[model samples]
Target: MEFLQLKYFQTAARYEHITKAAEELRIAQPSLSKTIARLEEDLGVQLFDRQGRNIQLNACGRAFLEHVNRAFMELDNGIKKVKDLAGMKKVSISIAMTLPKILPKLLSPFLNQYPHVHFRQIMEPPSILKRKLEDGEIDLCISPVPFGSPAIEWKPLFTDDIYLIVPTDHYLAGRKSIHISEIKNESFILMNTGFSIRDLVDKLFNEAGFTPEIIMEVNDPETIIGMIRRGKGVTFISKRDWQYVSHLIPEKIRINDPNWHQMIGLSWSTKKDLSIEAYHFKQYVIEFFEKT
Candidate 1:
């Protein structure tokens, strides 16, 4: 079957509805349907079962999806590799991330070291990033992909020690660390709900046999820090993230436990091509961690 047809199928299966997939692909519904039908014909297999207006993948479709995904992934990798070699050595690193605490501090140094390299950073959650990285849509993801996914190669960057961001005048502001149980009744202004960091927070609270009050939820750590500055609530983030804004910390170390930390890392698609730039960026990141 044609690659475009497989793409159409993927979009359709993703939404589980023809109209939505057509809208996403920006194509006419009838034309999309015909293309899918042609794909099924070419493959000599029924990929989906139509139930009234809704569609569901069949057993064969499920099996073929894996191969189709791999095919496109390899194609994208080949294109990137060719571009890396032909282009003006402007190695473009696609990073889906939360702004790191050390980004600005390290960026000038990084640029000075590799002036030819260019960066395309996108701030997104790990789940979306994991899907894009696996699909070869990005070169390297510099966020926690969560639970060590097997589809991509994972490189551990560092153990991100957790720190609590409390208001400048909070009761815990005078202490170096706060026990997890001490904040049993305290409300938290935290990252979005689906984040791996949030999951880690839950696990920590669970281990302490307490649930945070959870007064507010936010997506960005900077915003979380801002909220804490306004005394809205307290939140936790990694030392790497904290380093980026430690000057504004305002004596706000709300650490409940000193030992708690999260591991952050880099990831790349195992099925894709690794351009020299991507390779160099990965090595630089690893070396940074090692030197620290």
Candidate 2:
């Protein structure tokens, strides 16, 4: 019934452990348990199924938690709106992306125009980025692939062709284009697994019917380019990424496959209300891509 009771119940449901939730809430365990008990009594339904020391949210608990989450989200949105109306708080936007390098290009101009606005950025894989959107933890997500969730809305910003890149002096560098099968035996330097690009390239490899002889698995794109420049190995990179490595001038050959392109886009949860500042940034991102 009380706001504190609902807050305590939300935290308990998240952890499924009274002790852990109480620890996080910085309250005594007994007090937290009593609060939950009172809440259940008022609601006239058992929310959690209890074991000795652990608890699980029952069907009723899960159903109620959905409404509780929406209630908290709306309260947070109301606070943000009031702060915006009063000009009492500096606007901040939280963004998560799969591609870290593109953020500067997207944010620099916008930040220059609105110097007082603050930005919090994070780099996460596509799956985690999707979850962050649904949980309202991030205002927007820039991803190479669509999250494909009914609760999330995605818009394609641009598509870039994927290309095979190798050292200038490599044997196949003279060719303008090549099939993936032709390079099946060649050593590759690839982005590590879990990266969206890595997953895309892996699918291409699978379609080509052979596993690439990977000489290195790297996390940084610049490092992968550095290795390629030294003739260490070859790799696949999107066309837009060429701007970062153009000076090095590694040989970029087109892949003959029809599916060798990636669509990068922005996504946000349909369930959460966007703050005025966050909404502006989202529009800025869309226009930024349009002009490019």
Off by over 4 Å in 2: 1-88
Clashes of 1: 3
Each candidate's number of clashing pairs is: 3, 0
In candidate 1, stretches whose alpha carbon ends up further than 4 angstroms from where it belongs are 1-89, 254-259
- What lDDT is obtained when candidate 1 is compared to the true structure? 0.77
Candidates in order have lDDT scores of: 0.77, 0.87
Q: For candidate 2, lDDT tens digit of each residue in 175-215?
A: 88997778888999998888889999999789878888988
Question: Highest lDDT: which candidate?
Answer: 2
| Shift in Å, residue 22, candidate 2 | 41
lDDT of 1 by residue, 117-188 (tens): 777777766777888878888887766555356778988777777777778888888787667777777788
